[model samples]
Target chain A: MATQRILDFLATRRPDGPCLVLDLDVVRDNYNAFEKALPNSKIYYAVKANPAPEILRLLAQLGSCFDTASVAEVEMAMNAGATPHRISYGNTIKKERDIARAYELGIRLFAVDCVEEVEKIARVAPGAQVFCRVLTDGEGAEWPLSRKFGCVPAMAVDVLRHAKALGLDAYGVSFHVGSQQTDLVAWDRALADAKAVFSALAQEGITLRMVNMGGGFPTRYLKDVPTAQAYGQAIFDALSKHFGNCIPETIIEPGRGMVGNAGVIKSEVVLISRKADNDNVRWVYLDIGKFGGLAETMDEAIRYPIVTPRDGDAAEPCVLAGPTCDSADVLYEKAPYPLPLSLTIGDEVLIEGTGAYTTTYSAVAFNGFEPLRSYVI
Target chain B: MATQRILDFLATRRPDGPCLVLDLDVVRDNYNAFEKALPNSKIYYAVKANPAPEILRLLAQLGSCFDTASVAEVEMAMNAGATPHRISYGNTIKKERDIARAYELGIRLFAVDCVEEVEKIARVAPGAQVFCRVLTDGEGAEWPLSRKFGCVPAMAVDVLRHAKALGLDAYGVSFHVGSQQTDLVAWDRALADAKAVFSALAQEGITLRMVNMGGGFPTRYLKDVPTAQAYGQAIFDALSKHFGNCIPETIIEPGRGMVGNAGVIKSEVVLISRKADNDNVRWVYLDIGKFGGLAETMDEAIRYPIVTPRDGDAAEPCVLAGPTCDSADVLYEKAPYPLPLSLTIGDEVLIEGTGAYTTTYSAVAFNGFEPLRSYVI
Candidate 1:
């Protein structure tokens, strides 16, 4: 749906070279859709997904809370008119000063998966509501998170108990199935693990009041994905099954799922060439790449839907890449897409469903290529 | 060594968080070393390596040529007092306007791999000197380049002939053994491939005056690498064997080799933790990661030597990661290094020999974190 909007926007704006078109209306629609889908759950837009002020302002107007990964994101949300109470410091890793600054900025709720993080928060922001994130399989997500965060159920229980000992609020438990989650069962699995941590915490005389189902919602890219409705039903069914009668107040932090399908990237084909005797494979270089904007193509784990302006059939296969000098800046090569053989330099290509992660993850000065320009309609 | 210099600089600057320190003296020494090694070869410091004005200025004053890949880089070199004659637009893929802009800026030397690029150059800047880059195996390199560039011998010959037909000067042939090349034989193989294209061009009665060996010079990171003297001798021997009686004027576009050893990254260990019951693998998260500045950790392909301030022996194996919320930001997992187990939050670690690709390849903002800031000492 965003493709048509982006096409219309491009027709009017005539923006040039690797531009990201973010529709605030579409963002609002996604927010409203999430609100309706998870009626009982609090929605915090993960600001790291797309920290654009325009998008944040629209979300703020809709009374959406924010999951801030850093002090900058907290500021971004606040500058967009979000109060500190409506923001949660979501990232587990933080410098002591960042924690102090976030506390000074009025953010009370924080998520930590390690003892050091909890200790830092306890010292800097006393009695702050803390959520201990439990480890997950991180399976079935297009962008599987690293084992960089989250702790085992036992570790989570210990960390939460430590938080209580350090005079911080032993508030809740959180988990991420991973980014761009596909398997609905992933939530069921992660929730079961979370419930064990909750039970273990209760056994240690700590009563948890909240649960954050960290974002992992998927978008339709290259393939038809489950709708937000399905995700909502799956989450509700899993929560009901896991928590039984003791269902606590719930929070859902949806980053890519909320805004992913709301934006489109308008990039131009820079060149198309066959290296040496590369008979079967043709390389189609775009003005955008890993550094440019399409970094979610991390190992082709998240494939975006392509829409070219050309009328001819896109029957010929070609390896796709970005314009940066880095070889890894390539978008796709092994699983080549059926691009039009007639496509050449200056032809426009629209990569759809890149609303999230594109603008935020760009490597600004990689190859002196300009950071992807964005317009919010 | 730059270690003592960095320590001295850090003693005074006291820069906190992750910082890239580029040393101008080290750059000058590197330039002199390369000059001494490859006496006959023209040195074009690949500007994409580290486009810092100080580094550029030092190289410019040393009478070095620049291998520019973008309009901005072309301008950077010129702003650093490098004339267009001393800058070769090395990137094969370029927009027509960029070609025109480069030409207008007085850059005559260009690199092209295909017919279309040649056509653009011929139309935009007629009779411009064009170098045809041939395909290489891209083997034995930490950062394996994309097949997005260069063509085979026959294809290169045809493209050069087409350039001649279009009134563009098909001036030379070029090849990249790949970046951070370890196996010295890779250059020999690539040079051999370049020879075929060169011989074919001569059969068409076209003489190539310049042969550009695109940058792939290695920097000592985690292991001992060959010296600039050794590389110079190897290149000379290879050129003598390949071209026999008539060797073309030589050019070496070194990015990492020239600057990689001259810069050091001072990053703080953000958090160090292990998953529940995971007594085996300790995780040491740094304020820097793939996005922050250590992007060469492409599947642990390029390992930078770590120098920590800990007095104890570094015998503990740990997974390294960036401070970003992305799961994929894990730097090293399987190939765990013996980082000191006592390493904790705020512990400063120096990643040495990271001058070239580190700053240039850093992502602008991945998790609301600032881009990698560099200080030239």
Candidate 2:
């Protein structure tokens, strides 16, 4: 559906109902931008972001590889027609069964952080190509993966050398810059770190065949965040220049950066009340709460765009909250929106940029709310 | 299962894997305490807190009313042998289908907050006993429900009059003191407000039959928070003094206060890493992340008790986190635990008080982690 048609269909629904309306036009545009930025590198649409089968199918049809974190995500991608060779199980925590399933399904590329994980993977699937995830010393990223999953530079070399000695193909080096990363320089630093690891592995007589720059490209939540294309280009350029002729096949996993902007939660304003102390301060409550797609608001303190469906003369600032009985169900504090000419009890509010973790990591049935319906344009 | 048996069972499983172990002994004890505290009042086990069917059955066996917020919860309670009169459909955001389902299933008591809701309930089940949810101006509660679903005090009276005028039995006044409420005085103040409303309704020739003091009793989180029994007795005493012989049948909805301490999440310590600059400060990452029961850690900035199964020697403080790739998945910061004489790669750590919203709310399939398995004692 076109954006206008999707909005119109949603507007016709009960104004005080909770629903997730996905805009495929913007999703395609985002995909194309990533493809354009890193022309040589393969873009793996991270299924962990928005794993709706329809969205996955669309990305698969667009010739994008899938970055699956779990067996379920890999199954979802495969069900969506993604080829096995195009699926990379990029999570560090590998249970023996999950590794066996991934290997049996022809998922060749696996991300390994610890020696125990690599050993487990080797036991399960000896032929699997593994990427030794290296921890960058670089700080000041939004969500550094080094704290939990990645091995240090010295440890990475040791792990890779051990993997090669054990007859497992240590195929690549992977590092996550971080989630919602604002600084593009972080990727350049991460790539430099990757190159150093690559050189170290070469001295240990291991041939690395892939350079996986794990997903953390910034999505536009607020205006100040850089575009995904600009972020992708910086990493692509750094990898190309650093490795020169020795560069392996490049892979970029774009999770939230791709889908976050393509979806909006269209909910009806169920209740509106003015604060007794400050009459000017209004709290507009929607039918969806923190249990719905708005769980991101609780996690990241992100306030998405709260907009009116129809154009209005002037926008007034108001607090937007979910209908659940929790005080923490707030979506935005004093968000500005176009005021309706004559506001009624059941006005509609669009919470935009909710495609990523909204449905994928939601608790829909807590207050007996239904799971959101997904559609493709 | 008894607490000891559950712990033993957890100790035997992938004693090194992440899992939630619910202590049925503590749960039953808490249920008995609530029954004793609210001797004259009907105790509704708010199923939203911990929606395990076994728990519902146990509560029902203990002669507790089931406070249902959705059709599924109602069905769960009804399947557990809770009668229609023992169930209260308390959620304000009632979809037409849900209301109709409740009516068909013989659910009698309905909590209405707005004019639309009143009309919706009347149209669906005209014979249902309706309660006008009055918004209280009580302060210092953790989660004030007035902001979401309650009608203003005056509007509540109007709603009652309107319902009566429409030939609907608007039988009571209800208000929530809020969740995680520390101040016991807030209950007294809210009850005082309820008494004034009851008197006003009586003067208008309306004999209100029920006065619901909605759930917000403190759980065993912090040292300062009161126990469920203490909070329940405080409310009961306040209501008894204020209403005397004119007191209606009281109702209490206790969600987290009942199930909060009834369960513990048993997880294996997957990785222990120290910051590069600070070797003394260590972070222990468990198999469970925010996608599991540790979600509350991010929301409330509160940590649960992290204990080892084996009785060890001296205790040491360390940061605990989940196994997911997200950095915000930390369960506790600087949490003290006994350092085992021989702590190795796969030591077990049990996180207590995760029974409420842990399993039901935070089971997102990230990184192929297995969903929690529940075993009743």
Q: What are the candidates' individual DockQ scores?
A: 0.73, 0.34
Which lDDT tens digits does candidate 1 get at residues B55-141? 999899999999998999999999999999999998888988889999999999999998989989999999999999887888788
Q: Which pairs of residues collide in model 2?
A: A1-A377, A15-A268, B1-B377
Give the TM-score, chain B only, in order for the candidates. Answer: 0.97, 0.88
Best by DockQ: 1
Task: Point out the worst 10-residue segment of candidate 2 chain B by lDDT.
Answer: B334-343
Query: What DockQ does model 2 achieve?
Result: 0.34
Q: CA lDDT of A122 in candidate 1? A: 90
User: Which candidate number would show the highest lDDT if scored against the true structure?
Assistant: 1
Candidate 2 structure quality by residue, lDDT tens digits, B1-377:
12677767765664445666777777798888877777788888888887787888888888999888888888989999899989999877666667899999999888886666777778888867888776665466654444655766767777777777777887888888777678888888877767776788789898788888888775665456776667767877887788886778888888878887787777776655544323455566677877665666654345566566554664456666676656556666635333553444467666676777667566445444554545555
Backbone clashes in model 1, listed as residue pairs = A146-B327, A276-B151, A276-B152
lDDT (0 to 1) per candidate: 0.87, 0.72
lDDT of 1 at A82: 95
CAPRI class assigned to model 1: medium
Score residue B50 of candidate 2 by CA lDDT: 79
